[model samples]
Target: MEFRLLGQFELRDGDRGHHLGGPMQRTLLAHLLLAGQAVRTTDDLTRRLWGTADSSTSTLQVHVLRLRRLLKATGCSATIETSPGGYRVNLGDDTADVTEFHRHIASARNTDDEVRELHALDAALDLWRGTPLTGVTADWPRFPEVRALTEARDEARTRRAELRMTLGRSPDLQDLRDLIAEHPEREHTRHLLMWALHRAGRRKEALATYEDAYRYSVGQLGLEPCRQLRELQHLVLSGG
Candidate 1:
């Protein structure tokens, strides 16, 4: 069973999916699953569920009980255990999509083989369906933790694009352009776009990209380009 919170909240066991009840239940499940073997304190969970720490702990227990009943009804192997301060969700052999995404990224980075790294990065980005925790709403999704997943997804995209260019694959230049459009200040990805442009024989445009970035930094931000960007521009200028 995979608890998918990558997009919509769904308990996917094979092709069949167990209905995860209402928003509160979905948010609670998202919290515990994201905790990933760590106990989420009762107080922390209450604040997430109700947006205030004043909610009754008994209410939380009711939701946990309902979740357990749902698990038993579906015969899922996942277990929720109560600890001294809070609750922990054990997924057993089953995994969550978020866990798989992180694992894929880690595997990619640890690999020296560029082709293998590209594939792993692809897999990691593919796990995202849409904005994460789309259905799991309330205070939980509003926090930086959920936002971090989206940021990680964005980085995975840029990394994959960089790796593809390194492997001599014809990168989607438009992807890099779109990436820069969204994150002009992201020097690493901008470097990637410059490399892709240089490789594609767009030497003038590549230099112009650096110029545009330079103007943005010096004029708007009153800062110079980083050492890496300057070196890249030097390499591009000498046709290296």
Candidate 2:
């Protein structure tokens, strides 16, 4: 079985997909899956879900029971095991997308081979469907886990683009442009966009990106870009 938490909480046992359940149930499952074998104490979970509300233990149990029944019905190998004070999710022979994503990223980080690392990054990034925990409320005090996942995704994307440039691969200019447009303050992606434009023999456009970035930084944030960007602009100006 494969449990995907990068987007909606979904379980796939072979070709069949299981809904898991509604918002609260999905949130419960997400917490358990992220906790892995580590026991999330009953108090901790109740605090997260109910926040000092009265009569939460039985309610929490009902959610867990429903999750277990759904897992059983779907033939998923994962089980929600009861610990002394709380529960733990044991994946058995199953896997979670978040785990796989992190594993691939770690593999990429550990390898010296650029080509191999790039492929690993690709695998890692492909696991994301969209904004994580989609349709799940950010209201569980806005899960830090979800925020970390998004940050990981952005870092992976940036690293992959940098790797492509290093390997002399054909730069995806449009992607770089899109990234910069989304993050005008990202000097690194601006650098990347300029480099790609220069390599494509559009030195004029590359220099223009630097000028635009300069104006944006100074006008909005009262700060200039880092030294690398300025140096790259000089290099472009000199036709180097």
Candidate 3:
């Protein structure tokens, strides 16, 4: 069984996919999955689900029951185990996309072989179907786990672009431009975009990109550009 939480929440048994249920139910499962093997107390879950810990324990139990039933219906061997403190979903050897993504990223980071690392990075990035936790709401994005996952995704993307440039492959300029436009605060992406422009012999545009980022950082963020970005600006200016 494969649990896909990278985009939409889904459970796949063989070739067919099973729905995890409606938004609230999906939200419950998402929280449990994000918790991994750790027990999430009823109080913690209730607060996450309902914005307060005052929600009835029975309400949480109902959702867990439905999730267990859905797992059984899908023929997934995974189980939702109840402990003294709270509930946890045991995935056993089953795979979750987010977990797999991190594993691949770790392998990529650990490997000395650039070719192997690039392959790992490619596999890591391919797991994303869309935004992590696409449909399910219940304040999912507000969770610390989700925020960390989002940051990891952004780092993976930036690393891939940097690796491609290092390997003498020009990254898609339009894509870099769009990424900068989408995430203006992402200094890493901005730095890469500037580097890509410089590598493409568009030196003036590279300098302009850095200037724009510098202004955005200082004017909006009330901070100066990082040292690496400033050095890149100097390199462009000195015709390096």
Candidate 4:
């Protein structure tokens, strides 16, 4: 069984496709796929399906049952196990698109393959079509996958910045400058911009950029600029 939540939500068990009919069904399936191999209680699923409001447990069970039947019909033999207090969709027989995506990214990072990493990052970024939970408000808060994806996107951006700087590519400075302007609170972006400026012989501008980054970090996040940035500032002053 293969599940795709990137680009579109789709499930394929063997050669047959599982067509989950309603928004609720999609949400349920999404939660299950994102949860990995963990057992999610009925109450947990119910809260994600229907917030602090009235909802029938039987109704949720009905949805789960229907989803199970749909998976079975699609040729997935792995069962959605129901225990006394909870249920878990066994992932041993299933593959998630998001999981595959992260795996590819991790591989790229490990091998230091900048070209492959950039391509995979772009593909992963494109996978987000809209707000994660779109029509499912109950599932909005405390969704770890949503946070994970956000962090992944940021990580991709940072990696791209590092690669461009290391390549001694000057034209890439404008893009990084724009990124810093847009995300003034991001010290990582500022650090890259500073490095780009210094490497391009714009020493005064680079120092000024560091000052700005320090001020922004202190004012907005109530934190000092990171050690790397501070060290870079000192190195620049000493004519490094």
Candidate 5:
């Protein structure tokens, strides 16, 4: 059984996809999975499911029971185990996409082989179908855990773009443009975009990109661009 949380919340059993339950149930399972082996207490689960005031202990128990039954019906080896504190879904050797993504990225960072690193990074980035934890509502995206995961995803993307540039591949200009539009405040991405443009023989546009980033940082952020970004600007200017 494979639990995929990097994209849509889905359970896969050897080529067949199993639906966990409705939106709420899917959100519940996501909360547990995001905990990643740490037991989420009843209080925490309740708040996550239906906020602090609206959630009932009995309601939570009912949902947990339903989720457990659904998992059982799928014939997966994984199970949601109840403990004194709360409940935990033990994956038990079955991998989650999020876990696999992190594992690949760690390998990429550790390996000295650029080819191996690129492959690992490619595998890591491929785990994301759309956004991290798509479809589920109920404040899951607002959770600190989800925020950290999103940050990791973004970092992986930036790393992959950097690696592709190093490998002399023509960078995905439109993808980089979209990323810049999404995260205008992220200077590293702007730096990568500038490099991509320059590598494509668009030095004039590359220098203009740096100027735009510099203005955005100084205007919106009330700060100067970071050292790396400044160095890149200088490199572009010096025809390096």
Candidate 6:
């Protein structure tokens, strides 16, 4: 049996391909995938899926039973194993899109070449088409998947900034400005934009970009730009 969570959550058991749907099912599967070879307790699963609503352990067992049957019917070898307190999904290849993304990112981290790292980071970012769990909001708000996706996106932004600096397109301020406009809370992108503007001999415009970014960050995220951004802004203003 082959399980895939890269684009869509899918299970291929022999000749049959099963598309897993429903918010609860997706949440259950995602929770299992994020556990990383550990068995989750029933209480934890219930809390994650149903929040504070009073639910029985039997309810979780029923859901697991259904999921196990569904996988079996699909001819996949995936088994939902029952432990003393919880359950686990054991399948081969372990091909999850989220996992693949992290693997690529970790591979990019040790490389010295910014161009190649940027290419790999972009590919990892491309795996995310939307929110981590589309149509599934009940349980995802507190899940690790959300945090993982958020960090991956931020890492991609930082890598892009580094790549742009390495390419030395000082006049590439336009797109960097656009990126900041789209993600004003991303101070790193704004920092890179400021540098690009300064290098292009548009010192005043660069300063303005910093001002705009500062205001946007304070207003939108209720936070200030990072120290690096502040330092860059000061250097630009002082003609350093």
Backbone clash count, each prediction separately = 0, 0, 0, 0, 0, 3
lDDT tens per residue, model 5, 111-157? 99987898898898888888777777766567898888877877777
lDDT of 4: 0.73
lDDT of 3 by residue, 1-240 (tens): 899989877888778888778788888888888887789999999999998999999989998999888878777778899988799989976888888988999999999887788789889889989878777876666789888987787777777788889888887677677778878988888899998998888998999999999999999999999988999999999999
Poorly placed runs, candidate 1 (over 4 Å) = 139-142, 203-208, 227-240
| Better model by TM-score: candidate 1 vs candidate 6 | 1
Rank order (by TM-score, best first): 2, 5, 3, 1, 6, 4
Task: Give the Cα lDDT of each candidate.
Answer: 0.85, 0.83, 0.86, 0.73, 0.84, 0.71
lDDT of 2 by residue, 11-107 (tens): 8777778877777777788888777668999987887777664546999999999888887887878899999989999999999999999899999
- lDDT by residue (195-219, candidate 4, tens digit) is 8788878899999999998888888
Give lDDT for model 2: 0.83
Local distance difference test, candidate 1: 0.85
Worst 10 residues of 1 by lDDT: 133-142
Kindly provide the TM-score of model 5 when superposed on the true structure, using C-alpha atoms.
0.86
Alpha-carbon TM-score of each model against the true structure: 0.84, 0.90, 0.86, 0.64, 0.86, 0.72
| Candidate 2: stretches off by over 4 Å | 52-55
Q: lDDT: which is higher, 2 or 5? A: 5
- Top-lDDT structure, candidate number: 3
Quote the positional error of residue 115 for candidate 4 in Å: 8.2
- Hey, what RMSD does candidate 5 come out at? 2.5
User: 61-81, model 6: which lDDT tens digit per residue?
Assistant: 888877777666666555778
TM-score, candidate 1, is: 0.84
